[model samples]
Target: MQIINARLRHQAALHSLTMVDGRFTAIQAQSGPLAPQSGQYDAQGLLACAPFIEPHIHLDAALTAGEPNWNQSGTLFEGIERWAERKPLLSEADIRRRVHETLELLIGQGVQHVRTHADISDPSLVGLKTLCALRDELKEKIHLQVVAFPQEGLLSYEGGLALMEEAIEVGADVIGGIPHFEYTRELGVASMQQVIALAVKHDKLVDVHCDETDDGQSRFLEVLAYETLKAGLGPRVTASHTTAMHSYDNAYCSKLFRLLKRADLNFIACPTESIHLQGRFDSYPKRRGVTRVKELDKAGLNVCLGQDSIFDPWYSLGNGKLLRTLDFGLHICQMMGHQDFSRALDFITDHSARTLQIADYGIAVGNPGNLILLDGEDDYSVLRRQGDVRLSVRQGQIIAQRPAAPLLTPPWLSA
Candidate 1:
């Protein structure tokens, strides 16, 4: 396969790309003659870049808004309560339908890779079982990683640990825990320990929903970091939605920051959901409820952004576009400077790939032929307007394409 008239991120001019046996075999300047191939495409000089990565999402509970009832309070706890009310109603067909729709939306938005959490707190493990089947079904078009997430708690829920272990045995790729949601502080710490131990036992990755509350006293993040460091699974560990870090005192957070850096843990911030769910308790001088994105970047830590919910109990709006997530991230983080804007682009693309620990996941030779062509000239333009992806190609095949809009001219200026 040959793709002509392409603009790579580091190139000065449009170029051509060649794929052979699902790997990017060659990339040359457009000035060179085209090579013979089975197929060809002219991008019309559009920019081509690596596909976006969604590091944190809940596929099992997605697209479930207004199922039984609406969330009147619009708080995180209310969403959890509503989900608890709605969980028992989930069937295999119901889960498969929503998961397929969500994955299609993600693929249309240039997200070829995703890591979704499946609730395993239930003894039946229905959500995890459904997602594992969907993962196998969508393997050719989309890459999925399912986490055995204990949305309730490892010890608080009845038979939670046993069910989580069963999920891993079935085919879960990661182990997850909601430590801050445990009954007590001791239980929270114990939950973290259990999550790490289970990951080690199953040889799976660790991604924990740590300290997602606005309380300054919620310090499970420290426990998570300490366990990751002690277990020697730092790179494979991820801490999602540490919103409590924003409420902690400067001195304590400063100390914790040092330990987190030492752990080399990955951080994922849901700017869209966090901004909406947080600051509800404050009458004035409200907080952002998001983690220290700029601070973490400055400290050389890997920080990524996630559109945590889409038309679900937690959030009421989303279209699976990662660029929209980047737009919100820049505003909430106050990262509008030139350098910061460039880095914000990485928040959804490169930084997220790092969080997912994807191997050979870039636009380079000998890598899988997965890339997206944006309707913008450069990164600045892409983020400035939240540009659209005109084309999405996976494994040398064009899976999705957006038609180019027709050019319009004013009637008053007609020749």
Candidate 2:
């Protein structure tokens, strides 16, 4: 397969790419009219780059909004309660249907890599088993990483610890915990220690829902970072949705930043959900309820964006597009400067690939032929318009493609 007239990222001239046996074979500057043949594609000078990656998402509970009741309170706690009310209704067919639909939405938008959390708080382990099966079943279409996530606290909920262990035994790629959701601070600290120990014992990665609360005293992130440093798991550990850091004082955060940098923690910030689910308890001048993205980026830490939920109880809206999430995150983080816009695609592509540990994930000669062509010429234009994906290719096979929407203007209405 050949892709001609492709405007690769960070390149000035148009280029051509050749793929053979699911691997990129050649990439060079286009010198002549290399017309695409039967098994080739013509990008037509559209911006081409590696496919997008969803670093954090909840596929198990996707497309389950307003099941028994809606979250009228608009708070994170109420969302949890609503999800609990709907947990018993989960079955293999239900989960499979919803997850497939959700993945289809994602695949249409050029997402070829995803990391999803399967709730292990229930005794059935239905969610975990189904996601594990899907991970293997759909390995050819997309790379799926399953996390054994304890939505309810390991120490606070009955048999939660054993259930998590069972999930790992069944086949979970990563170990996950919600430390801040525990009953007490001590329990939260203990949960982090247990999560780290289990991950090390199983030789798996760690992704904790750390400090995802509005309380200023929710200090579980500190314990998580400390444990990550001690275990020497640095980049292998991820801290997702540290919204409580928004409420932390400058003095403590100053000291905490040092520890986070030393630990080399990877962070996932769900901007759309955080802005929606957080600050509901405030009266006036509410907080943003988002992590310190700018500070973290400036500090040279790895931070990426995620679409945490899609029509789930926690967030009631989504279409499985990482660019939408990146747009919202850039706005919320006040990253609208020219330089920021130039580097904006990193949030959804390179940074996320690093978070998921995707090896050889770039537009290079020796890499897999997984790339997408958007309807814009550059990062700034693509993000500014929330551009459409013109073409999507996976392993040298065209998976999805769409023409750019045309605009018509009457002569009388022309400016």
Candidate 3:
């Protein structure tokens, strides 16, 4: 397969791409032109970018809103209670059905690589098992990475550590923890040690839901950083939803930022979920429930944005669109400034690819033949208009394509 007469964003001239055996074999820009093969796309001067990466998500429990009951309180704790009520009734068949549907939705939105957390706190391990199967079944279409997430606290839940280890044995790609939900400070520290040890034992990546509370004293992020430094897992470790960092004192945060940079830890902020869940206890003059995205980036740490939940217990509204997530992130973080807005685009594409540790994951020659075409002329234009993906191609094959919709005008508006 060859794509000719295409203009990449940074390139000086139009180029041609040849994909063979699912890898880009050649890219010719200013040299000799290559003839098009049976399949060819002119691109029509549209911008080409790397496929979107969904670094953090929960596939096992997605699209299950109001199953047993709705979250009347709209609080994180209430959502947890609702999920607990619904977990007992989850079957392999039910999980596979929803997981497949969710993957299709993501694909249609131009997502080719995804890292989903599966809850292993339940003794059944039904969700983890179901996603493991689905991961293999959908390998050709999408790359699904599973994390053995202890949704319930490790020490608080009965046999939680054993279940987590069992999930790893049954083929989980990453090890996950939620320290803020533990019973006590001692238990939280112990749980971090347990998560790091398990990752070492299994030689897998670490991604923890660390310090998700709004309390200014929530300091689990420091513990996670220390453990990452001790284990020597520099960039392979990820800290998702460190929302408490937003409330921390600036004097403390200034010092903490240096340590995070030293540890080279990756950060993921779910702006939509954080803004909704945090600030629940605040009165007037509320604080934004997101981590210091701009601060972290300024300190040269890898930071990305994640769409944590989609129509799940935690969040009941999501269309599985990464652009929507980016939109919320820019507004909440106050990153709408000129240069900052351009970098905000990286929060979804490049920064996320770094968190996932995807190899050769870009629009380059010799990389995997996976990319997307947007309905805008440039990067900032795409973000400004909240552009939709016009074409989603994987392995040199068009998996999903959308025709442009005609604008609708009313008679009354014609005046």
* Best TM-score among the predictions, by candidate number: 2
What is the full ranking by lDDT, best candidate first?
2, 1, 3
Can you write out model 3's per-residue Cα lDDT over 1-415, one digit (the tens) per residue? Answer: 7777666665657677678888888987845344555778766656677898899999998989898998888899999999999998899999988988998899998899899999998888999999999899989999989999998898889999889879988999999999999999889999999998888888999999999999888899999899999999989999999999989999999888878988898999999999999989999889889999878888899999879999988899988899899988889988888787645557888988889888898888889998888776666777887867888889988898987667879989988
Clashes of each: 0, 0, 0
lDDT tens digits by residue: candidate 2, 65-170: 8999998877899999999999999999999999999999999999999999999999999999999999999998999999999998888999989998899999
* TM-score, candidate number 1: 0.96
The better-scoring model by lDDT among 1 and 2 is 2
Error of 1 at 406 (Å): 3.3
TM-scores, one per candidate = 0.96, 0.97, 0.96
Residue pairs in steric clash, candidate 2? none
Per residue, candidate 1 scores C-alpha lDDT tens digits across 182-245 of 8989999999999989878778898899889899999998999999999999879999999988
- The top-ranked prediction according to lDDT is 2
- Candidate 3 lDDT (Cα, 0 to 1): 0.87
Span of 10 residues, lowest total lDDT, candidate 1: 30-39
